[model samples]
Target: RTLTGHESVQPQTSREMLSSGHWLIPTIGGDVWLERPPPPMWWIGIVYTVTGVKASDSIARLAAVLAALPIILLTVGIAKRLFGKGVAVMAGLILATMHEFYSYAINPEADIFLCLIVTAVLALFVSMEFPHVRTTGAVAGSGKPSFFGTRPWPMAGFFLLLGATNWAKGLLFGTVMAAAPIVLYLLGRALQERSFHPLRPYLWCWGWLIAGAAALAWPVAVIGQYPEILQLWQEHYLGRLHRGYLREPWWYYAVQVPYVLLPWTLPALVGLLCSARAAWQHAGRERFICCWALSAPLLLSLADGKHHHYLLHCLGGWAILAAVGLAPLWGWLQDKLRLIPYSAALGAVAMALLAGTGGILWYSRIPGRWGTIVGAVVFISLATWVILTACQQHHLLRAFVGILAPILAAYWLWVPYQASYLDDYKEDLVFLRGAESLIPNDVPVLVQYDWTAPLETFWVLYHMRRPGVLIRDPWQAAEKTANGGQNSSTAYVLARRLDLPLYRRAGTVETVLESTRTRGEKNPDQRRVLYRIHFTQPLPPAPEDYLRVVRRTLW
Candidate 1:
């Protein structure tokens, strides 16, 4: 926890932590956001407090890790029930092996938590439809067909949490809205056919949870200052949705699926192909699982405005399906080692893969000898581990684990170096940090054309701990320097990319370096949003073409 100036702790990817700092604190002056939205995620803060690792990068990312734990548990539960414990373990491993899931679960982003909560809701609701009272591998209440089987509470609470997740991120709320109602309604029809009163309990519990969670989460600032909160929500969440400035082609999620999901997609897709209507017939829960795996991706694909992260929830459904899909293979193995010859053939193929992968690394002329060697070691070790486990009395669980272990290990080694992929956002962070050291505390930071929230979060987190004037607009920034008799003239800003040449008249606009860590990616070629600058004097009036209409640039 060393700080160059302010007493600050350095966490894993110090720059990324700083980028996210805005979520925790308020430092931007005169901004009208609510003082603090009742932190729906205060538990994250609690985790840091209890573990004393809050100051560490791990603490910042704890929420994601915690969220992923449930998916693992539920996969096991579903696998054990639908197939066997062996399949259940295999399913969980397949999920953990996916680079996308691991990346999200290892970061501070809210997607992993979204994944966890959504998984919980699905598991609980499915369990309620098929209670444990019937342990004979039959979907409980198939003949009776009740939604409210034995456990309704889990489903009830998840609805509340689902809403709370919306409060955390608007996209997740949208996911729930799109998916949950249809699922519930279909389950309700099944319950009706079985002559059971399931819908009432389902509605009562879920309805109360949603309302109660909202009341608990209603921003205190909104109660005390309504206008400010509304405006903030409008500008921040709803406005962004309306504007859709970050819009991507409809196929973006579909395109990213292979890279994001990696090794798991192969097996999971195979699982979907193998799913049996005969096995799942009359099984409402199994039907829902199938629906979940396929529908979420289709919905995301159809979305007009989409982002890569929206599909986090879809991965869990895949894991469970893959587990179920692998169940048959696992079952066949349990009876005999008769499949050994076939598996050994596959093992030989996998060995060739391992050797070829090692050779590629050795020849790539990669920097860092240790990391490269470590990667090669991981690849071979995992392939061998999988082959050995496969050769054992077949545990579908072990089979999946055997295959997945190496992939996960390879990922554990590769992704960190690949983090340069987020170079788009990193350039600005680097520029800001370099500027921070040279620029005086009194200098007003005139932000460029865009709101580089990531860069803004960094400066705010660092500068808030040491209060100073950091203005955003050129006009307002000039005013701070206008009264130079009483106060020292503050440095303003200009963009190198905009190339207005205003800085030449004003004096100087020095460049700063800003680089943030991108998860498991190498430095990328993308442009950063904000470029840090230190102006020696007020920005000259905008060119005649633009200055006339710049009435409210200061705000």
Candidate 2:
């Protein structure tokens, strides 16, 4: 799939960095774009350099996948440290198969990278502080705890990642997301233990100085170059805390939790309930995992800004909790089904798998999809036979295999199919390519668009390989292209057909290139036109516009 929406930002900025040879500051359309920190761009740049391949969308997305692999391993390690090995395996599977996590794994966005770093930081903190927590039937830890509850290496790694969170997202957002949970867990521990011992590790860790230094490095360097960026940074970071940006209701995240968790929603809720009960009785790993899981969503809910992707940071904790809830349920199924015959259970499972496969094949009877249908059928049949053969020794094994096999198959088959099918929804890149061929490389292009709809402009800048400037107001474009203006030499404006009248009012507009394409399944008549504007006279100040009002209202 082509990069669309904000996903284009990653490769666009990386290309700029490589072309301009300015790694410290990232640029988009030849303008410094400090809205996002430079780590994801740096990762993409590194991938381009190491592979010696042209920077394509696929290669850029590969960087995100590489970053996500560590998150899965870290989730497994964290679960193993808190629960037993059984729960660890289950937790890793749940996280890896989750729809949101899988979507972001290949997406060229900073959220997945942020999630990786945050998970690492919390995992190290758990290993350090709760190294010897007692589980249901076993104790989980590497060995006896060393000084400060961990050795020097892990302590240094924890502080380093904790500070590196700033680079993942920004100076304030990542640090707050990581630290809030630690503070909550420590407060809970202090209340339960009736001592200040839980706070000792934080006080003694002077490696925080290293973390602080690392976090401040980029901000200080960028601010030194452009002091005005300090104000922009404040508006971008601190402004989200109030009711000005992406404001949703207080219970927004609560409503989204079930959808995000998908198949594990009920199990995660049960696990959360069990952990809450356990924490009420004692201070242990349950409390720590609970804090890790709930802290970010709770804190983000309090703030006005909310988006579904922000919940990625909390997925690790929820996956572990789902495992915690699923382990006993597996045992319960074994005990409850002892009276049922083994042949009867296997027959029932086989019948259900056949029915599901038959229904899918019936529904997806397209001419070209027959290959995929046959493959899915054969895969399901083999998987069912293998499960039945392997679990003949024990009913408990049969029950576990029965529950997990379908999920694995869906992750391998259905997810990819859905992604491929949805790739046809947005045709921005197709139209932008058509428009790109019409405009010369030497001519400057100004993308006239509303502030809210910058995705197409970003697409032009990235795919067209031109220094495109986004102008929210038509007057801005006229001012730039007016006689004796800075950009008066052969400038063109790319805008939608609906917005052509507004641009015409600002100047004498000539249609250079007009293209029409379906935006998505719902909006099939989308049209875009490139216009060469010749400013005849200076336009007076315009009245208040609806787009400007909406932009101000939101920002």
Candidate 3:
């Protein structure tokens, strides 16, 4: 709900709205969100159109979250098919309770949806049979659900979803996420059958995949609507693979694994260790899950631009492996219920409660401390009871009971508090709403920023519900605000503290509003001031601004 919670869009939520808004506009003259492909945004726009609800950040994000439900179901199906009913249950529960999954669910981005599609692809890939070389296509009693007399319908589904995934993000992500597992499965099949001819089914599957991809409307619509899209894709998206904006070291995704998959990272690693042997043995279920999980991130790490959301596609593999690791423990507990002490388990839960409560109280300065503590205590107490009950029952549930407390605590306790603390734009939204009358609708608003932060653009345009532009520097804005009697347009410029001195030196800047964003990881407390800088008398443009623009145009 974070995406839709604010009347004005929040930081990352703004980016979502901007892209989706472009989709809603008519394709003829509409602007496109060029950072990536437009499938996610276009789909969201379709949702808004069908529902007749005002297309807002919340609605767009809700669409993605709803689409994400299948990721869990598909994971369960794949796990049940590969491992067993017990492993499937544990895998589903782990995925359902995961912090990474929950965080992305609320985030109005394509990552979760991509995860869903990728998981579906893996599920289908895992369901196929690698028969001996002689019987590649015409197997009578194979017991597999064949769609095209080539491979199972799930294989076809993989190709269709891969097409959608590509449209949502880009070709590279879709290709790697889909192709790696298929290649690995084929290799494993060939190794197992002792013949290269076993790969014939996969070759036929590729033809089906190509046909399914061609049938998708996104490809036709995108090419028909935006002819220059190829150029934009190259300059904006593909360029990032080698050297473009948001470049990071090769080890970037490697470092992010712990943070992105927090609270589950340890279990996931343990799961990988436990399943390694089975995965290496044959082209069976275990091997498929392992290859599916490891391949995407390894391939993604090769790219120069790394973001946290890209790793979400691997959630299926990670969750299944973790379940593999936890499955033996569950079996052991079931077999020997008398080995563990409930008293010790309860004590650990109590310590966790105290640590959680004490940390929030010590660090949180916001109101509602009492409510947060009470909530934590109650949740922890409930979790402790669950552990005790599961221990008594001697079931697979006890496996979840151990980790459920902390995971739920993060969901119930820390996330709400973090959201409250991280509301850096709350005051600005309120202020904008209150003083809406002071700002005229006709006066164009321009945000002066060196980097792209769609949050500012979203809030300003959303609050004003008017035309706005994000330009590189204050000087560009200063020139835009100039009124030479014949052509006059007053511009509102929002700038951070570092850029404030430049605005001050440039014109008679009247302060509109000032807001401060709290400090957090990798960022200091930042102050931003908005100015109603009218160029009734425009200042001379800086010479460096001209040179910069010339260099950019030339480049």
Q: All candidates' TM-scores?
A: 0.67, 0.79, 0.75
**Higher-lDDT candidate of 1 and 3:** 3
Model 2 weakest 10-residue run by lDDT: 136-145
Q: All models: lDDT?
A: 0.51, 0.72, 0.59
Q: Which is the leading candidate under lDDT? A: 2
Candidate 1 C-alpha error for residue 258, in Å? 5.4
Candidate 2, residue 14: CA error in Å? 1.4
lDDT string for model 1 (17-44, tens) is 2334544322233232232232424545
1-555: candidate 3 lDDT, tens digit per residue: 233222233222333454445442122111233344555655565666666654465666577667677888888887787667777877887787767787777665556656766677666655555222212222212344334556555655656665665655555566567668768766776777786565655555565657456434555566675565566667755666887567888788778876766667776887888878877765566676777777767877787777776777777778888887765655654456456566546655776678576757664663566675666567666665555455455455555766565566667767567668555556656655544545566655565642334344444554444445555555666555553222343567765555665666556678777654411213422455567765535466567855475223100
User: Which runs of model 2 end up more than 4 angstroms from their true locations?
Assistant: 132-153, 334-402, 424-426, 441-446, 465-489, 505-507, 518-526, 534-555
Across residues 1-555, which tens digit of lDDT does each residue of candidate 2 receive? 767657877788888888888888877665666767898888888998888854677888898899998999999998887786877887888898777888899887888888888988888887776565444312122344434354467777777888899996777788887888888988777777686666655653367776888799888898887776777767876677884688899999988888888777877888898789876666677887888888888899888888888889889899999878865654554455555566444655676577566757586654336566566656665665554443343554355556567667777776567556656424555666667788766556777643435554555676665557656666766655554255563458777766777766666778876665634323422466677777656565655774464223111
- Candidate 1 vs candidate 2, TM-score winner: 2
